[model samples]
Target chain A: MSRWEPDARGRLERAALELYLERGFERTSVAEIAERAGLTERTFFRHYTDKREVLFAGSSALQELLVDTVARAPGPATPMEAVAAALQAAAAVLQERREHARRRHAVITANAELQERELIKLAALAAGLADALRQRGVDDASASLAAEAGIAVFKVAFRRWTEQAGEKDLSEFIGESFAGLKAVTAGT
Target chain B: MSRWEPDARGRLERAALELYLERGFERTSVAEIAERAGLTERTFFRHYTDKREVLFAGSSALQELLVDTVARAPGPATPMEAVAAALQAAAAVLQERREHARRRHAVITANAELQERELIKLAALAAGLADALRQRGVDDASASLAAEAGIAVFKVAFRRWTEQAGEKDLSEFIGESFAGLKAVTAGT
Candidate 1:
């Protein structure tokens, strides 16, 4: 087994999702994932700490992207506007990987433990966005509310985006969902 | 060892919280909790499926309260208004159990697994609220957005309510949080 495997990370992710879908997440093993990827278990360990980590490997990166976008919003932007911009930025990134996002959503939706992990990731992203807002001088209560509301929009929009045919962009759904959130909150 | 234990449920809950606080949730056992409460493990099992269930015992009742409130809102009430009413109703219930809620919050905050469980419960509550809104003729997207936004407000308000001294009522905090939510979403 050569140590210099090309695109091992991507291959491992694809293999893991395929196995997770073919056999339930609970039934799939790291060894099988490695083998299915034409790689060694040692290489799998090098890429991810555990089988579960394979499914969640992108979460931290996504959170960082959200926080960065929030921090870099124009100085005069409102908290919700900043949050909306960050969500749209995320939507743009997700739009480039629509198939992967759909498959990953399916895998997470089929398993309770995965769903819990997904919730934790979303919660952490909200916290990160709130921290970014606070750094921008938004008050604590408002910062937290805007970030949470933003994540709520993202969740709804992302679910709708993944469920629909590939006609509209994820960013459009995000924009519409944010508008929907505003309408509902406005009691309209 | 009698089967007819008085206040067994309450005793078990208090005992479980105490043990979880003192020894941590991972170290606490059903047998120890039962012993602390002066009941047997059988009584504990009868009341709760596991040690973790002690902290979440009220979730279903809380969800029912929220759903019923949403369902019974005035015909002309907006989705957010109905959600706000449901949240206020829940706050009123939690107001009476401030100390218990505080301690439980402490225990759950200290543990990752409990926090995940808490997130799952909140997600379920949001789903229930959305369903209730849908039943009230709200559109699917509007119902989900309102429910998720409502839960986000509840999370922030409940946290603030628990963190502060009992000078203000939970319902008041709920009202303020909903206003804050509207303000942020309105981009004020």
Candidate 2:
């Protein structure tokens, strides 16, 4: 029914990034985004709760995916290993979404408020991973420690992944960063 | 020379906490905070950036203190030991401000937006510590890992320190958590 003909969600996200990048995030409105997408304001609302939500549409899903990945991880793995596996799973999921990921990253990095929201979301994801580890009988301190380490690894890997071009892989970067972080901290 | 005869900053902090507890953060403004503190808007701005800032005035100072503590630490200490020393240093700088810390914690907890800002601030502080460690000749990735691990230890210890009734020393709690995390990740 929409003129753009792309999947509604993708179209909405595309419309949002264009607008948010052109005008600052605080200046962009939902109606403007809807118009750009060739979709109705109603459809836009259906896709996103508000202008800010457009900036974070995938965050909730990403958190859920991270938590589920941790939950379903194979038993017998150390907490750090379990988290590394979950991050690898996440990288696999994110690999196909490079364009979208880069767009979101640019938007977030350009705005302090959005960056703060993004950090908070990552913190929530870290907390969820810790909780999942705790559910697997890891002690609270161990769970949080491993979870925070996982976040550090993920962050460094994510930065590396986005900084490069080509068929470069997030999982590979994450694996290297994990090894690097371990080496960085090891035998000390 | 300031209004309220002495320690205008303390007076503003107290007044702001009162207002924030009575009427949530979003509803409070600079004028209201200044008025509650029995000072003018100029005085308020002189002491703090804005309403949200009054609660976080100590964080930058805390970061500087921690960084200095890490930088001045004897080079022979392991990363964890160095961070532990910095954390104990924080306890010394922070203990006298316990009431303000509790008030700020309550305010930050009450608002998701504030929590985001707080997390970002913590992330920045962690990065600063990592950079300081790197300056001490710690390798890059390991510096971050140790800095983050130290943050984890501080978080655990601070939580315990805040929960206990009066007479609980924050330094001891920090030491305990430091030992605990080192034990948890000791062989890993």
Candidate 3:
């Protein structure tokens, strides 16, 4: 067998999610994940530090996408508009891998520890978005509120997208959720 | 030493926060907390399940206050208005214990693990607020969005209150944050 494996990271992630779903996150082992992927444990370690890391490997990339999108938003865009654009960019990324996202979400929702980790990652994303907004000269409080409100919309929209059975685009849900947020906060 | 102790819970909480701040959360132990409080470890156990619980003992009460406030808002109050009221109620409670809240905030800020726990508690409070909104005849999406937006305002405002040096009231910060949130989301 070649020391270099093709799509090793992707294979390991799929294997890890499948095993986590089949046997639960706590009961699954790194060795089992690697074995299921038909890759050696060393290859698994090369991709992820532990079994849990497999579930969150994309978080950094997602954060970068969100921050970059927010940073690149038009000068005329409001803080909320910049954040909305960022959320739409993130939704586009996830839309391409709906099945994988669904499986991963199921696995995460089943475990309390994973849920806490997910919350932490979401919080980090919000912080990143807030920093990006602040760099645009948005005030501290407004930046933080806009970033957090954007995240809240993303959370609601993502859940709705995952649960509903249809071809409805995640971006549509994002837009709808943002509008819902606006109307509710408008005190109407 | 008498087995019965008055204010045992409060004493344990204060001791735990002091030890956590002095030695860091990872370095602090329940035994040391009890010793610092001049109480038995058994008393500490009776009040809290673990050392971390000391920092979060008020979370349940806070969540109850939030949900109850939302539930009891005047019949004509909008969802956002109800959430605003709940946040003000929560802020008022924290205002009475400013010193303790500040110290606890410092201790949690210094520890990643405790930060995750803090996020989880906030998420739970958001969920409780959403349920209360739903019970008030608010739709599913609106309830969640309002609840989450309220939490976002609370987070930004609470951090400002703790970090700023002034005689300003927390409720004032909460009101300002809600106004900030509305302004940002107004896309102006």
Candidate 4:
């Protein structure tokens, strides 16, 4: 595999997204993306199986970041706190590519298949986070609930961050969304 | 549409589940499902667009149950209370079909396509519940959060209910799961 081609994957992703936007995801071809990225088709194949994967390439990394952060959370911290910390950590990684993320979100939402893939990725991330929490000694039910609620906050906050016109940071949006989850669930 | 075909839909669903389990979802055919249901291919098309829709046939009914329950919740109820009430109400409809729900869940979890469809159904249910909450004067963020949390609780509780050997009712499980969510999210 040409995985060590240094930024080849990133270049292909950028080119694919641009072409997908211009010609629709279905019309965009892997060869065109490779050509646009100034890389051979073989290099593109080494990096991604197909065009759809270019958009989903970051799912595993984000999942690992969330799982690692939750696993390392202080033992005394509440489950929600641990989840909040994990979201903030993930948000920090995402903040650097806000524009790219926004564009990717638009492309995904514009297509049903992409949206399904996105939901599946989020589901996997939640499961990973829950498993990590369980490894940290949290019980099954609590870990699953905390992980799900955290993902819920992440989804809602990410949408808000992508749509907002101001300069608000993704972490702030994540924190506010977590607080909103608490407020919404708080009994009368 | 043969929407008024007496018991045809029910028969098809039962037949579909049996065939899906016996032959596996990928190998199951619409013709076999229609034949097993003692119906013709014509009747099958009258009911469902495809075999996949057989598994998702109940989504619309469930969505309506949730939306209507939320819309009719007590005027002063918190968003979460409204969601909890909605879930309990929906649970009543599901409780009578415990065996069938268990079988359906098994088929869904056994297949990636079915799992994606399940997630899509849950997403649609959340959107419907959120809109219902908004109609009841809940704020946007609160509505979305409560709806997502309700779905999370439902998903976890339903899994527990299905996996348990005892005869506990679905409503009881839902109530317990909602409480578990509160416990999970409670911070120090």
Candidate DockQ values, in order, are 0.76, 0.39, 0.77, 0.71
- For A2-76, candidate 3 gives per-residue lDDT tens digits of 457989989999999899989999999999999999999998888889999999989999999999999999999
Predicted structure 2, TM vs. truth: 0.83
- Going through the candidates in order, state the TM-score of chain A alone for each one: 0.97, 0.92, 0.97, 0.94
Clashes of each: 0, 0, 0, 0
Put down candidate 1 lDDT per residue, A45-123, tens digits, no spaces.
Answer: 9899999999899988899999999999999999999999888888888899989999999999999989988998999
lDDT of each: 0.93, 0.80, 0.93, 0.88
Instruction: Compute each candidate's TM-score over C-alphas.
Output: 0.95, 0.83, 0.96, 0.94
Estimate, for each residue in B1-188, the C-alpha lDDT of model 1 and write its tens digit.
Answer: 34579889999999999999998999988999999999889889988999989999999999999999999999999999999999989988899999899999999999988998999999999999999999999998999999999999999999999999658988988889989998998883
Please state the CAPRI-style docking class of candidate 1: medium
For model 1, what is the C-alpha lDDT against the true structure?
Answer: 0.93
What TM-score would you give candidate 1 relative to the actual structure?
0.95
Query: What value does the TM-score of chain B take for model 1?
Result: 0.96
lDDT of 4: 0.88
Task: Chain B TM-score per candidate, please.
Answer: 0.96, 0.91, 0.96, 0.94
Query: What lDDT tens digits, residue by residue, belong to model 2 across residues A1-188?
Result: 45555687778788899988898788888889889888888988777788888878777788888888878877877787778778888888888888788878888889988888888888888899999999989988778777877788788778778877767799988877777656544434
Candidate 4 displacement at residue B106 in angstroms: 1.3
Candidate number achieving the greatest DockQ relative to the actual structure = 3
Ranking by lDDT: 3, 1, 4, 2
TM-score head-to-head 2 vs 3, winner: 3
